[model samples]
Target: MDRITKLTSEKPVIIFSKSSCCMCHTIKTLFNGFGVNPNVHELDEIPGGREVEQALLRIGCNPSVPAVFIGGELVGGANEVMSLHLSRSLIPMLKKAGALWV
Candidate 1:
């Protein structure tokens, strides 16, 4: 498995994102609201972040920043996250993944 795969599997929630992206921040904030300290990989700040992004794309991810993963599964991007939240699925997912205690 690649670094991304390994990390995603290790963390209950993980976000591969860019620091400057508003959607990224939004997703991060949403997780925080749920009291989840998601493992965040800031793409723009790392030397080979672009490559990792490309790798994620090739693996059929959102091909953009704020790629959220739960239990090693791609949970899509910002809009997906918001939709899940609105539908009350996000919390269940978090709980199933052991990311949310309450």
Candidate 2:
């Protein structure tokens, strides 16, 4: 909750991820491809990770990993990200969030 908020606020784009989740990898790659240097927290490898994961769950992230925050707001998981991309809304959002320069 508070911790998540704090973490999300520290960056223009933030991705809460797991080290081995393929979907997480894909989402990260997508952001990188767009030139957005998101702050990534590998929950599986960090201290208090399980508790952070639980917090994510309580906040409505079903699978939890790959939770993305853009401009300090949750943009959801892989599916949502891909949907936004397909709709051509992702890059604009990234630009608005100051995550992308172009």
Candidate 3:
């Protein structure tokens, strides 16, 4: 169990992504910019990371590179993430997950 898995299985916010993914990098940067520490998993490195992969797959996700999971819930791809951000809902959701500071 790596840091990401441990965090996902325990923490409130988890992001599974690949190193080459711009969306992954971007979302992470945004969280960091907000002074938030989000747990990250890079599927490109882990073997049999399919549980997370399959979870995303069930939602008709097109392997767009980065998958965001909140409180062990799959929140969808980058666009969904961006949508939440634009609506100012992401931070509130994070707070609900206890993943954000007050």
Candidate 4:
């Protein structure tokens, strides 16, 4: 949890992902398309991936890749992100989180 906390606090947009996950890639691409360079943490490449997965679950998320966080708060998975984006709610969240300047 400490590592997760540190990451979320340090970056306006942090994506907990797995390098081999297609959904993770899609989410990253989505952010890129939106002109936001999110801080990506490739869990499978990290040392404490399992622990981190457990930690995410403890916070009520399923053990899934591309767990998005903005302004130090969990924003759910890719589908949630897509929903937000489609609803036009994503930009405001990004701006509020300081992940977008324009």
Top model by TM-score, which number?
2
lDDT of each: 0.89, 0.94, 0.76, 0.90
lDDT of 2 by residue, 20-93 (tens): 99999999999998878999999999998899999999999989989999999999999999999999999999
Candidate 2: global Cα-lDDT?
Answer: 0.94
Better of 2 and 4 by TM-score: 2
Candidate closer to the true structure by TM-score (higher is better), 2 or 3: 2
Candidate closer to the true structure by TM-score (higher is better), 1 or 2: 2
Clashes of each: 0, 0, 0, 0
Give me the displacement of residue 70 in model 3, in angstroms: 1.2
Tell me the lDDT of model 2 at 67: 97
- Return the lDDT, model 4, position 60: 69
**Residue pairs in candidate 4 whose N, alpha carbon or C atoms collide under 3 angstroms:** none
> Any runs in candidate 3 off by more than 4 Å, and if so which?
1-7, 50-55
Please give the range of 10 consecutive residues that has the lowest summed lDDT in model 1: 56-65
Please provide TM-scores, in order, for all candidate models, with all chains considered together.
0.93, 0.98, 0.80, 0.94
Model 2 misplaced regions, further than 4 Å: none
Q: Which ten residues in a row have the lowest lDDT in candidate 3?
A: 1-10
List the candidates ranked by lDDT, beginning with the highest.
2, 4, 1, 3
TM-score of 4: 0.94
| Candidate with the larger lDDT of 3 and 4 | 4
